[model samples]
Target: MSPLHRLGLATARHPWRTVVAWLFALVALGGLASVGGGEFQDNWNVPDTRAQAGVEELRDHLPDAGGSSAQVVLHDDHRLEAAVVHEVVADLRSTDHVTTVTPRLSEDGDTALLYVRYDVPTTDPAIYEDISGLEHATDAAADAGYEVEYGGELPGTATSLQGRGELIGILVALVLLVIAFGAVLAAGLPIATAVGGLAAGSSGIALLAGIMDVSTSAPTIATMVGLGVGIDYALLILTRHVERLRAGDAPVDAAARATATAGRAVLGAGVTVLVSLMGLRLAGLPTYDAFGFATAIAVVCVMAAALTLVPALCALAGRRLLPRKERRAPEVSRLGAGAPRSSTTGIVETREVKEPLTARWATTVAKRPVAWALLALTILLALGAPALGMRTWPQDGGSDPKDSTTRAAYDLVADEFGPGANGPITLVADLDTVDRAEVKQVHADVAGLPGIAESGPVTYSPDGKLAVWDVEPTTSPIDERTTDLLASLRSDVLPEGVDATGYTPLLSDISDLLGQRLWLVVGFVVVLSVVLLALMFRSVVVPIKAALMNLLSIAAAYGVVTLVFQHGYGASLLGIDHAVPVSSWVPILMFAVLFGLSMDYEVFLLSAVHDDWLDTGDAQGSVVRGLSRTGRVISVAAAIMVAVFLGFASEPAVVVKMLGVGLAAAVALDATVVRMVLVPATMTLLGKWNWYWPFSSVVEVRGAPAPSLETSDDERDDLEEVAR
Candidate 1:
């Protein structure tokens, strides 16, 4: 027996022991995570970049310039009083995390802005608490008829929607599973296994957090992937178990066989996901690296649960796994009143007696291979067309929910001072000599630039060797206009002695860096996936076809994201108020995730086909047999994933929403158009060449028979029965 069969038997033999052990591990890990898990760091550390160099210089030379800053905007219909403004500024300066506070009164005096600098990055929990308290301190201005709003990283960090996205996803998945399996017990087993896997995975992320700088978004992303794939992996295994039970195998023997077959597929799919996620590390961004590791941990945990816990549950449930209604006798019609009536019912008779529509569709596609293949390719290509115009930028306060304080503050700042006031570019200069005249001239030249809204007075370091000036732009932080301004300043406008180091410029630099490195990362994942698929399937053409199809699916997903989020095609439907650039890290992360997920269907369908081909040496027969066998389960699994992913579409965070919508669309297209139509059609056209290799002659010379389309009708009938 294979090791997977051995594992299933071992788990089945001692179900309670396995259950108890998993429960104990979950509890212990949960407790440890609660106590020792470190905070997530939003560290966008891009080494050997100009931004890093500038930041390091400031941190080393100027104490007050090292940390992040927040903005407090006060608005009133009437002219604001100087006294009240002073009082608010004094209160802000008194806050524990506030290092310095600078107040600016609008020309009309109806608005006031206070810039408060912090001693640490805004993602620090302590800094967030301090900012919250500062907001309360500023409440007195609001009480006095002045509208108070908080902006910048503080409010943005504090207002993340943290409720029930995962829970809702799981509930939706459960409903889909119930509908697919038609058995509450059968459906619940996958969910149970998923929950256990998620518990362990989440705890593992927490432990990793304690040791490294994981991103704040890692847990949410990990949860989304872990739950969807966990349930999917278990569902596949359980479906096979049900098939074996219906075939009249004993419960333990059925579980072992199912595990040996479906469990191997699960392992391959999980490893594909892991490899894709780990490819994020090649992007050379800390956030992506952390995301990769955290997600990989979750996948590993879920894959293990599918292998061990799912089989244990299957063994414990036995024939009772199927719903009672499904297991009961079916009503058969009598051909004639005079004829002797016989009531004959078995598991398959009571269940779906006719072949599924998917089987018929596969047969039709196989008959017209070229046309179906072209149609599938056309659909995917059309969907992916919009990706050509995709843009990337960091999400800012403008993308925050309108009700959030950050959004309010952003609007007030834009309405009063300027949109650029919310995101200013600071110039830090290391001078050979303290020449006030030269610094003043440099500031004037910067202010005269095309996109400049205004410029702050230059402030020099105590030793007078360094100077800093805040240059406000005429657009929002995430606007392409602002990026253009940053580019001109860095490349054309700024003097040789000066360097830009501010939130807007830093974000632009990060976006550019990610965009530049994106291709390398994509190439790595594609090549890695290709090599892995080639080795597993032992065919170059199959791996190449799979990789290309996966890319097509991912591109379609990107195009959807571009249309909805970038072009505002369906922005309102998804609750987005306006079009925004795709988040810089989103496409890279999405590619890794979607490629791996798309492979899940490919692996499932092709592995079954390969097994059939090894037995019968007929490629076309194997493709039909494989599709007819795995199509329903693949459809059900894909539906579960789509439901789970789209469940998070309502997330207030635009990034999360993008991920949700993109993943859902990708999975839907991949499972149906690509898997059902394109794959079988392509294999039909290739015939025995589908499995050809340069080394085939050597194997053939060693007395191995060549693969041939010599399968008998009896063998086809048996395969069809097995599929059913």
Candidate 2:
């Protein structure tokens, strides 16, 4: 027996031991996490950008002003008392890691702004603690009858994973499972394995956070992927095991065979997902690297659970995995049309065998392949049209919930001051290299720029080697016009020695970097996926076709996201008040993730089709049989994925919401239009060419006798003609 078969047999024979071991591992990991886990932080430090150089220059020459900063906005019906503002400033100054606190009152006298700067990088865990202390200090203002809120990098540096989305996704998955399997025990097996894997994977991410800069969103993203794939892999294996039971195999043997077959496909699919995710590293951003690493860890844990825990559960469930009617009926020969021999139940009523709906649908497509292909293509292209106008920017405080302190602070700052006040572009120059006269001239030019609302006097470092200029734009941080202004400043206004660095300008730099590298990541993922598919199927045409179809589905999903989130098509329904650019990192991350996920269905369907083709030597017949056999399972699996993803789509974070919607849309399209209609139609048209291989000699082509069918002689003849 193969190693996978042996593994399956061993686990099924000792189900209790397997279950106990998994439980122990989960507990141990959880314990380790609780003890060693670190707080999550966002890192947008792009190394090669002009913004990064500017930051480095500041850090080298001006230690006091080189750290991250945030704003405390206080509002009252009357002018703020000087004593109260002084007390708040003293409190902030005493906060840990706080280096400077500057207070300014609005001309209207109703609002006050405190600038609090910390002596640590925004990615440091201490920064979160600092924000907490700042918030606590600002609470005194609230006690004095003033409304207070926080804004800027320090306040917006954290990403939260807290939401009802994950729970809802799991519940929806369980419901879908029960409906699909027709037995609670069988359905629960997948859920149990999935949850076990998710718990362990989440714990693993916590541990990973201690060692590296893991983003707070990593755990949530990991959970989203791990839960979906964990359930999916287990379900695939369990389905095969139950099929084997119906075919009269012993529980151990059935589980072993199922593992040898379906488990192989799961292994391939899992590896593909891992490889695709790792492609995120190529983007050369620390945040993207963290995303790739954290999510990959989750996928690995879940895949291992599916491969090992699923067989044990299947063996334990035994005949209970089958439906009530199937349990009472005698084992029917799956290879031939045979009457039931006997039954445990006294009444052995027989029912006519009708053709499966999937099989009939396949036959219809085969009859008019060209029309079906055209219809699927047109739908995909139309859905993908909106992608042409897609725009992307990094998430800003403005995207936070309306009630959130960060959002309130953002709005207050924009209202009290100009909108540009919220995102001041800092210009740093090395006085040793650039003349002070030239620096002054650059400042004057920037002030006269079209988008410039205000410009501050140049402040020289104590060492006299560094000078900094602050310029406020006439637009919000995420505004395209702000980006244009920054570009003009870099390209025309600012001289070579002056570098722009601030929250807004830094995010713009990061967005530009991601946009430039997006195509390279796509190419890497697509080419690698194609090669993997070709190796698995041993057919050139199959992999190419699979890649093309997957691309179409992804494009359609992108279009949907652009329309809903960027164009405000249905933004209100998702709680978004206005159109916003898609998150800059989302499309790159989504492409890597969705491409791998789309492959799961491809492997599931193509593996079955390849097996059927090897068995019958009739290409068209195999396509019909494969679809008939796996269509329901694939559809249910896709539905579960959709439900899980849609759950996350309802999250408050726009980036998370965009990713959730994009992934869900792609899966829905891939499973429906691509898998059901397009795949069958295209395969029917390809005929014998679908199996063409340059190295066919290495593959064993079986010429076994065709299996007996439930169809009438006339129907069989028609199918054979279509196959020819």
The Cα local distance difference test for each model comes to: 0.83, 0.84
After superposition, candidate 2 runs with Cα above 4 Å error: 31-41, 329-351, 697-699, 704-724
**What value of lDDT does candidate 2 attain over all alpha carbons?**
0.84
Model 2, position 606: C-alpha lDDT score: 88
- Any residue pairs clashing in model 2, and if so which? none
lDDT of 2 by residue, 1-724 (tens): 8899999999999999999999999999999999998777767678899888888788888876778898999999899888888999999999888888978788898899888888877767667634678778877797899998888888875546557777878889889888887888887888889888888888888898889888777888888888888889988998888877866777888888899889998998998898889899989799888889899989999988998999998888888888888778866544333545221111122465566688899899989999999999999999999999888899888887776788888888889887888898999988877989999888888888779999988999988998897889999998999999899888877777787897788889888999899999989998999889898888889989998998999999999999998898988888888889989988889988998898999998888888777655566877887887778889988998999998998887778889889999999999999999999999999875687767743344353322232335665455444433
Per-residue lDDT of candidate 1, residues 106-183 (tens digit) = 889999888888876666667752456677768779778998888886767766656567778778878887888778
Where model 1 places Cα greater than 4 Å from the true spot, the runs are 34-36, 329-353, 433-437, 698-724
Clash pairs of candidate 1?
none
Please, what's the RMSD in Å of model 2? Answer: 4.4
Error of 2 at 538 (Å): 0.6
